[model samples]
Target: MNALPRRRPNPLSCLAGSLLLTAMVSSAAQAAPSQQLIDAAKQEGMLTTIALPHSWCGYGEVIAGFEKKYGIKVNELNPNAGSGDELQAIKANKGNTGPQAPDVIDVGLSFGPVAKQDGLLQPYKVSTWDSIPDDAKDAEGYWYGDYYGVLAMGVNRDIYPESPQSFADLNASEYTNGVALAGDPRTGNSVMMTVYAAGIANGGKAGADALNAGIAYFKQLKDKGILVPVNGTAQNIAQGTTPIYFDWDYNLLAMRDKLDGNPPIDVVVPSDAVVAGVYVQGISAYAPHPNAAKLWMEYLYSDEGQLGWLKGYCHPIRFNDMVERDVVPQALLDRLPPAENYRKAIFPTLKAQSEAKTAVADNWAREMGVQ
Candidate 1:
């Protein structure tokens, strides 16, 4: 369906690709949260979350629903903080039992293991833990995948009437001084993954090889003056400065709705290379409200919580389970970008992401002139 009026392209095409799920097996009825857990959380009184901007993954409504249901205050800190910042906050406030310390964190998949290994996380398996994909969670329950977003581009139609079809299309001079990433490629997982996708599109293998290829592609863009050093944000998109901004599909979808087609925005998951990024959720080791933190996890892993994320265009860790049970709302399913685009999308292994992180952090500045 058309995204808006007469000429506007759908922000997302109806997805047609199979979700690479190994746990599409059927399951019994869901186990609702235990009353004991809910009571304990209420006694603790508050849950502090970090790096959860409402627009990121339908978090605004989810948080509100939790607070309303349990009457537990959710003290949000640094709405714009990145995964690194969340980890830093946890370390810095290990001794302080105050609002500054985060009780829960939603971070890149790679950060989950790091945080657990660093003694910054505590394990508490949700009741529906069995439904969560094995690859998306820690066996010991220290961390778990909350939701995932596919790498996609947000194109401003005001500047270029036609949308770029693939990563290679961005190399055209027409996008000169316009190509950007929502995050800094040198340190941001999303941006790094974008590079990975581009690299794969340019004929690099997945993981380290793709990252190298991506770097080479960027170099080409840099030589052509088609790449911009600026971090693309919603404001920048509206301003028409960064006309072609590569970012998570959820983020771009939110921007599309927010913009309401003012200048028009197209969220396209490039056909050449499709990559999905999963963000994990963990309870901070130093959480002052441990019970509250546990309760928060229970709420999130529950169908209600997973559906909350789906409403925001995020594919929850329990997506396969939900779909198998025929629980996902058809309306939401219809809005997803066509699955054919995601046919080749690969969820990079932790090893791949780690290697990419190292490669980009070490070489971005020296080779591309910016970190």
Candidate 2:
């Protein structure tokens, strides 16, 4: 019978096998598009950032490094604007395709969900998404914390001779007309947290309903003539105009170099209460250069980015992660206060923060007699 023809594998089976293999290859290829994203971002060639001060959180170096690495130009707007100003810029420039419209924003932590609710932000998780703490990020990736700092007392040593180490010390006759806040409590997150910290020192808990103690504490400072009405600035601190500032630790730490230590600025995390506040990053809903914004996000969360913030004395959100990985530099680590100081650091819950903001805004001016 002509030597029975060798049985042939089914042609249909071979075709189906080829198709499945092709699909698998395509799926693997689509797994990550980081390189594709870089190419697209390069094509965009420009990024717009709002309210990012080069000196704040090492943004100056971060922006320079990004520009050098990608050859994309960054247009920084309103370097001195506050978190509220950043949000306002996005809303004001909505639907515009110009440089005035911000591509990314770094705002007070409480503003993250607010932006998300207002549809001002877009969801985009970075390659290191899993590395971020779940509680520090939005479920849909609308925003994630970049860095944080503790509210501390920054005293001009030349003016005070001896620095106050506790919130209660500000009420002493020695600090009369010396105490000032970073900004108005009614609108500034730093100022609000300062009050919150004071309240904690006065036996108040960290909750919306528990801010009365903080309010009373500030009222006492005002009554004693220790609370200055002017906002504390580096210039004011250097000139001894606002010799004792209740501000962020990073800001005070930066003043040491900014003022050349003429009088020397002493930063103290109060023994009674250590309150920490976070700053969050988000991509604009109407980013003119979307890919570049995404790339910026990736850079900010990367090891290089986190270390950059650390260099500026701001604790990166991934600070603990860096510690575990042994990636932080020894010098930078040494600059921070002892671990014990942060052991009692208390971060407000989102609900608590919103409540606290409202409480401050509604009662600050009325209670303290300053707008």
Candidate 3:
């Protein structure tokens, strides 16, 4: 037995054993790299973000916290840009490793799949991925919803003493030329969601067919001279130029605070329908600082990060989860609309959203005579 040394289990077997060991080690090395990622990101020392307005969803605090926590500098580009602009920036700066490139984006929910399809987004699931709702995230992690807002009617009480409580109330003769939208539904996500909410209020559902009802509703507003052509803004509301504006609850809430009793602003999620729209976060496919992007995602989805959004009046995507875990502060929770108000809140399926968007784009001008 000692003579052959048991043939050493054969030379070919030894080679196979060595290959298996190498593969195992490689896999282990690849799988356990959280600390490695942190180190690499620290070395990079920089990140680039696009279209993140400081006021939107509390991004200012988030960016500041991230920089302070990691000592990484974040270069924000086009803070006032729209979701469409964000996608264009990614395409325009593709393959560029300079400061101009965007490392991450937070876009409207409809734009998430579009970015993924264009190969502009990379898959990255944060540590809190499990807590996120299935409907709010891509299965493969290409993108995930960070926060959502309900479409609400914002009324300047100085202009309309009796605030509109329902979408139907906006159609009253008294509200003629009073209703305004944040932007054209053809181009703005908020406006699009407003139209969708109208559809839901009018006995229509949330699919392709339902979109026609939305268009019809807007068309009627336009015909009755109730729909103002001007884009709605907090300034416009404060000035009484567009007293009754259709906008996200968060925006209206912030506006109410900014107005601060000079002209009381009232926000009401239409009693007839409560519809919520989501904003998604994604890492750029060509991110120059990939690890830093990952770290940012982790921060955005963490309890601390979700709370930041809450501080800004936007509903975090994991709000329900946070409530269940009792992680949400009682004071903050109290500020939110009573839970019963959200009982009827409806979210359109991704397919329905795509179809509805197409419907809006195709017929908005024809139906309402405004593009």
Q: Which candidate is the best by TM-score?
A: 1
Q: Best-fitting candidate, measured by lDDT?
A: 1
Query: Measured by TM-score, how close is model 1 to the native structure?
Result: 0.91
Candidate 3: misplaced stretches above 4 Å? 1-33
- lDDT of candidates 1 onward, in order: 0.82, 0.78, 0.78
Clash totals for all candidate models: 8, 0, 0
Tens digit per residue, CA lDDT, model 3, 221-311: 8889998888888889889889889888887887787788879989888998777778899999999999999988887877788888998
**Between the candidate structures 1 and 3, which one is better when assessed by TM-score?**
1
Tens digit of lDDT per residue, candidate 2, span 33-80?
A: 389898999999999998777767778998998898789999999887
Q: Which model, 1 or 2, shows the larger TM-score?
A: 1
Model 2 earns a TM-score of: 0.88
Which pairs clash in model 2? none
Q: How do the predictions measure up, each by TM-score? A: 0.91, 0.88, 0.86
Which lDDT tens digits does candidate 1 get at residues 175-286? 8998987767754668888998888799987667888889899989989998887779889988987888998899899889989989799999998877888889999989
